[model samples]
Target: MVWTLPEPMLAEPVNNPALPPGFAAEPKWDGYRALLARYADGRVVIRSRRGTDMTAAFPEITRAAASLPAGVEFAMDGELIVWEGGRVAFERLQGRLNRTAAGAAGMAAQWPAHYVAFDLLRRNGTDPDLTAQPYTARRTALEELFTDQALAPPWTLCPSTTDPTTAAEWLEWSAVGMEGLVLKNLRGTYRPATRAWRKYRVAHTADAIIGAVSRSLTDPATLLLGRYDPTGRLRYTGRSTVLPRPLATTLPARLSPAGEEHPWTGRTFSATWGAKAALTVVLVVPELVVEVRADVSRDSAGRWRHPVKPVRLRDDLAPADVPLFGDDTTTSLT
Candidate 1:
């Protein structure tokens, strides 16, 4: 039976960790979502969430197909994670993401990726399409397959628990760069391209200077935040999600247009990381410090990998009170 990998199912953000009845929760690994398959004819494919072929970028993972018992074929939904300093390092994975096969091979030795499998899409290359099966059934088959094959290293079975107390404990893993918890209904089917699961991020509040805004100073739609480096340079850190109406109405009184001396006076900000679209922003005085809730996922430079949530204006705090750009003190919350 020939089978093809499908686009991965996605997760929606939830405000809290309380999962509904009959749901199972797993730690949300901070890494790229990828689908892997070992074909019945011995072909192996690794694909990104957007359907980009990533087999060449992760040779070790591709070679992991060899560990499967002869004639055993399977498809898995998982994250590709790399470790550094004894914790999952998302930046290490980014460095090798687009590398050439030879380039990736060299870097793999120092920062090899581990595939953390969360769902089994098919097994034994002969399936009634496991995606159509209930998640509990798929999960049981996945664990059994791992034990039967003695898989190791590049392959890891993601931990899942039906107990709410255990799931809540996993949220503290943010100190080691885990994003948070992903909860899936045990009876839910893996509908491709659908938000079949929900996520609860482990968040920490920190101070950031408002360097720019996406709209008028008085009614800004989004905030472009920054933190001072050791040299006192105001570095563009990350942006917040859209501001609520109340916050938008209250910010104008606190903002002032940037002067020539502003660090980002003429710098352009991308609408999103790696996006070609440029944001039309009004540079503002960087003296206004604000508190934001963000997850532990970050680049090597300590920039937030996901849009932060604006909590409130920190009128009592000064820009200097914020953590420095390279300081992990803010994100290293347990």
Candidate 2:
């Protein structure tokens, strides 16, 4: 017997160009990629992104799925996210994914996963065949099926808006750790593994003080500049391409070798730029401040993307007062 499943949804990397006019935009949620399956016998299965059976991993989801109105076999697509402390803790989900039966019971009591159902692919004995239906039609069916409370932990319908300006506003004030806005054609059908949809992302940045410099493991002359947050905590952002050009000769004298080894240096060198070059070693006291831009989004580790671009030095400002954008205040999971 052939089991019905929803067409796989496609995702584009964040921080790209804008979509064409008249596209509907939705918030890119942070959670495990999930495919909800319901058999005619009222059995449900939640599959993970890697095709692992997560039905047993999330008992609450199973219980909830069983409670949904019967006489139907359906498949839904969405993310399994645990909302906590006003943020989506991806690490919490990861912990739950690897738990044993006993461990899952304990973790369930601590952190519960919320199934955010966004699309419906099959309904009852009818093959919705959503690939041929426009997004509006598919979304309407999803809203109708989830209108009742038979499903457990409740499911949130991913809201879609047509206003690009409003969508842009959402991207700007995205405290929920949104990757970006996904724009779908109102009349377009779902296409698996296709880039028919467009994604627009807002990049975030901050001005930080360069606390020190580290030598590049590849390029002897290149220097990796280290910056500090407002709280005086040091973090490596990226290397300075311009710094080596100006102070190439004087770098050796001003540099201080790091005592402890850095984890990033040992890894296979992958360059954001074209060529692979030797790393540099240099350390400076916390003195210089620079503006940096980066694509800020949560990874599987529940941490925002790091090592944004170092824009330029802030000559008029003090290193102690450089502002940090999108700190702990902005979150959507709570």
Candidate 3:
């Protein structure tokens, strides 16, 4: 029976690093989540989490998939990453996305992508659907296929370990662009779009200046944060998630309207990257510093890619105490 790829399975956030018994932990790669499939007719497809066809945008991955041995039809779940400066460079991988075929080919020569397969969806036309099978059985099949096919280069088998010590050790791989860990139950089945897996990403707290805010100053929703670069430009670092009721009440007291010289005076902020909706930003004096807990994930410009969790107002800290825009978290987020 021919197997078709399903929507990507999602993972729920987890805080503990301890790997539970009967669960296998894999280092969460800091890159785009993709599903790859090769058909009996020699057709190859690479798709994104949102069901976008990304085959043309990543010629290197497409070429690798097309090169699989005859009759090796399979579908696999994995990440698309690029290695640069001795580590995974997610910004480099972003260069290949949403490009013309020719443009992608050129970028591929400079920053080729690698597919890190972590889950096997199906093996071949004759094999029964693997999504219903337990993770252990599918994982074993995936390993055997890798060994038998002698996959190399663009193809990578993600490391999985059931040992708690090994899983904890993988967390340190954050230095090399690993986000953290995805712990999967051995007896679990692949349920697309379901939070059947647990994810633990590296998180840290840092200080940022409140340059603007969403909603009225008296009842703000989120704080737009910024940090000065070496050139003394207050670059937008990231924004906070919706404030807790108690925290929301405390901010208006400390915040004041921005002066004429505010860095973001004429600028408009988007609700999200590439989003069309503009945020209702109320520019504030860039003096109030706040502590925020953020994941290791960042954008090409060192801005936090996800909304940071506001810990508290760091009244003791000056705007200068925050890390420079180009100083911290040199990575990219999903």
- lDDT scores of the candidates, listed in order: 0.86, 0.62, 0.85
lDDT assessment of candidate 1: 0.86
> How high is each candidate's TM-score?
0.86, 0.72, 0.90
lDDT of 3 by residue, 1-334 (tens): 5557899999999778789989999999888999999886778999999998888898888888787777778889999988887667777866466678888999999988999999998886455579999999989989988998899988999999998888888877766667889999999999999999999888877788899999888989999999999999999988899998889987899889988899898898889854669988999889998888888767557777779988899878888887888576422222
Error (Å) of candidate 2 at residue 56 is 2.9
Question: How far in Å is the alpha carbon of 3 misplaced in model 2?
Answer: 1.1
Sort the candidates on TM-score, descending order: 3, 1, 2
As for TM-score, the candidate ahead, 1 or 3, is 3
Q: Please tell me which model should have the higher lDDT, number 1 or number 2.
A: 1
Assess candidate 2 and give its lDDT.
Answer: 0.62
Which lDDT value does model 2 have at 87? 64
Residue 66, candidate 3: Cα error in Å is 0.7
Clashes of 3: 0
- The clash number for model 1 is 1
Per-residue lDDT tens digits for candidate 2, residues 1-334, read 4575644667665454454575688876767778888876889988876677888888878777877666667788888887776766565776666779889877767888888887777776455456678888888888877764344354667777877667767675445556567778888887765768776665665555553454442223433444444565555544444443434454445434444453233433324322357433444455556565544454432234434555555677775565442243222221
Q: Sorted by lDDT, highest first, which candidate order results?
A: 1, 3, 2
Question: Clash totals for all models, in order?
Answer: 1, 15, 0
